[model samples]
Target chain A: AQRVTQVQPTGSSQWGEEVTLDCSYETSEYFYRIFWYRQLFSGEMVFLIYQPSFDTQNQRSGRYSVVFQKSFKSISLVISASQPEDSGTYFCALSELGTNTGKLTFGDGTVLTVKP
Target chain B: NAGVIQTPRHKVTGKGQEATLWCEPISGHSAVFWYRQTIVQGLEFLTYFRNQAPIDDSGMPKERFSAQMPNQSHSTLKIQSTQPQDSAVYLCASSLDITGSQNTLYFGAGTRLSVL
Candidate 1:
């Protein structure tokens, strides 16, 4: 079974500080896809980023960026200049390509609290 | 243009009751995914559809959970004999493209299920 494990359950950081959320996965497939999502109290889940293993390119959109490392079987999301609005539950998900299943295995989320 | 739309943002049902969750994918999207999220289990893939056909449902519970996508624009997930344990947030996501590395899933606000 493929599983994405995000060890940190909760973390707090001050505004304008850098915060990192770690994710690691174990799967038999040689390649995998990773995704980051933020879920708020309103029951809305927002897509933050998506990364495929073949392309090591770090996806950056404004203050949010994700780094995918194949060798370490890990992925990390870095928030630069974090703000209060960034506080939410962050999740990591993965799926192996070619399966058409479109089923994504997600990790237990990390709740981030950005303080003012 | 509405990304993914899920109906009945919240539902309350009794054990053994039946509940159905609906999802309308983006206008031109061909892939739709359903996931269940809870505090204990986090996010789990329930099933997926590609090109209006059932692709994979390996993550679904066999007895009470079933999903269908009769057309490209909409999909439905039905749960029979709903139990308190089945209560969770059901999320739907859609992507314009189903293949390759660029497929990004845009999600809905999710439907929260409450069972008594």
Candidate 2:
């Protein structure tokens, strides 16, 4: 069974400050992927970033990047220059590779509040 | 591309009533997924379909929950004898294909089901 965990239920950040949200996962599969998504207030989920377990180098997309600790089975999302508009519940999801199920296991999410 | 579209932004049903949620995936996408989100459970995978075929439904409650993708244009999730415990936001996502490990899923706004 694959599972994702986000220890922090809530987090806060000031405008223009950097924010980091942590996540961990348990998976028996050798190949897997960790995904991050932001749920907007309108109830839409926006894909943020993803990291593959086989890649030693972390993945980065614009201001959003991930610190992937593959050895520890953990990953952290770093958002630079956070703005109030970034406030929402962030979800970390896991998908086992080589499995055609295409199922995603998600974390409890962290409600982030970016104060302006 | 208009992305994925879901109907009935909100739904309310009393105990024992039936509810149906709709989802229209993006054109050309080959994989569709159903997920349930609640304050307590976060996001849980319900079912998935690929190439218009039922792929996996291990997470669906066998008794009252069922999903179907009759055509490529849309899908439906039906809940019979809806209970208060079934209240949640139903999310639908679509991926271009499921064969790749980095397939990113585009999500819809979701249907908020409130069971009273």
Candidate 3:
């Protein structure tokens, strides 16, 4: 079975500080993908970034990036120059490669508070 | 694009009542997914559909939960005999077809179900 784990249940960061939210996953499939999503206070789930297991180079999108440690089955989302608007509950999810269902097994999320 | 749309932003139901959550996927998207978010369980994969067909629902409770995608534009999650434990924010998301390898999901502002 594939599972994702977010050890920190809550985290806080001052505005302009770089914040790193950690996540680890267990998957039998050597080829898989990890995704980050932020659920805003208004209850919308927003896709952030994703990392495929095959890619050794981490992926980045604007101010959001990922530190993927494939060997440890761990990945962390790094948000640079954090802002209060970023406060939300962030989720890490895992999707196995080749599963036509496209099902994502999610981790217990980390609630983040970005204070300005 | 309007993004995915879920109706009834909030729902209140007593025990043993039935709750049906509706989702309208983004236009032209071929994959729709359902997830449940609670403080404890976090984000749980409830089910998914591909090409408007039921794909996988392994995470769904076999007893009171059922999901259907009758057409390309919409899907529904029905829960019978909702209990307090069933209370959660139900999220609906849709993505481009898996064949396209663009499985990133765009989500709706979920339906918050309060089971009393």
Candidate 4:
């Protein structure tokens, strides 16, 4: 069994400031991938970024980046220069490699509110 | 592309009634996945299919839930005897393939299901 945890239920940040959402996972599999997604108020889910278990490099995309701590089995999504439009629920997900199953176990998510 | 398309953006069902959700994956995407989202559980993987074949359904409820993909383009998730607890946002996603570390999923604007 695998589980993902996001302790922060809500987060708030000022415009242009950086906001970090924490995530941790427990999995016995040696290979897996972690993903970040944002759900808009319209109910659409937008992909943000991902980090593979084997790659030690942290992934960054535009205003979004990931701090992957493999030793502690934890990861965090950092949103730089946050804007009001960045307000939404951000989810962290995990996918096991070689499972041939496209199933993703997701965290409870952190609702982010960015003040303009 | 239009990305993954889920039908009936909103639905209201009476107790014991049946609810069926539809999904149309992006063209050329070989993998499709279904997930249920709620405030308490976050995103729960319901099932997945690859190349029109049922690949994994371990996350689906054994009795009242079922899913099928008759072709490569579309899939369906059916919930029998819908209950109030079943109310949630059901999401559909698709990816080109489910291999290695590059399998990124594109999601649809989820269907919001409400049981009365």
What C-alpha lDDT do the candidate models reach, one value each?
Answer: 0.87, 0.92, 0.91, 0.92
lDDT of 3 by residue, B1-116 (tens): 68899998999999999999999999999999999988777788888898988888888998999999989989999999999999999999999876425888889999999999
- How much does each candidate deviate from the true structure in C-alpha RMSD? 1.5, 1.1, 1.4, 1.2
Please give the C-alpha DockQ score of model 3: 0.74
Runs in model 1 lying further than 4 Å from the true structure: none
Query: Could you tell me which 10 consecutive residues in candidate 2 chain B have the lowest summed lDDT?
Result: B97-106
Q: In candidate 4, list every pair of residues with a backbone clash.
A: none
Which model is ahead, 1 or 4, in terms of TM-score?
4
After the best TM-score superposition of candidate 3, give how far the Cα of residue B102 lies from its true spot, in angstroms: 1.3
TM-scores for candidates 1 onward, in order: 0.94, 0.97, 0.95, 0.96
- Which ten residues in a row are the worst by lDDT in model 4 chain B? B96-105
> Which CAPRI quality tier does the interface of model 3 achieve?
medium
Docking class of 1: medium
Number of clashes in model 3? 0
- In candidate 4 chain A, what residue range of length 10 has the lowest lDDT sum? A96-105
Fraction of true contacts kept, per model? Answer: 0.72, 0.77, 0.79, 0.82
Sort candidate 2 into its docking category. Answer: medium
Off by over 4 Å in 2: none
Q: Candidate 1 lDDT, tens digit per residue, A18-55?
A: 99999999887766688898888787888888778888
Choose the strongest candidate by DockQ. Answer: 4
Which model scores highest in TM-score?
2
Task: Write model 4 residue lDDT over A28-110, tens digit each, in one string.
Answer: 98889999999999999999999999999999999899999999999999999999999999999988885656578899888
Better of 1 and 2 by DockQ: 2
Give the lDDT of residue A64 in candidate 3.
Answer: 99
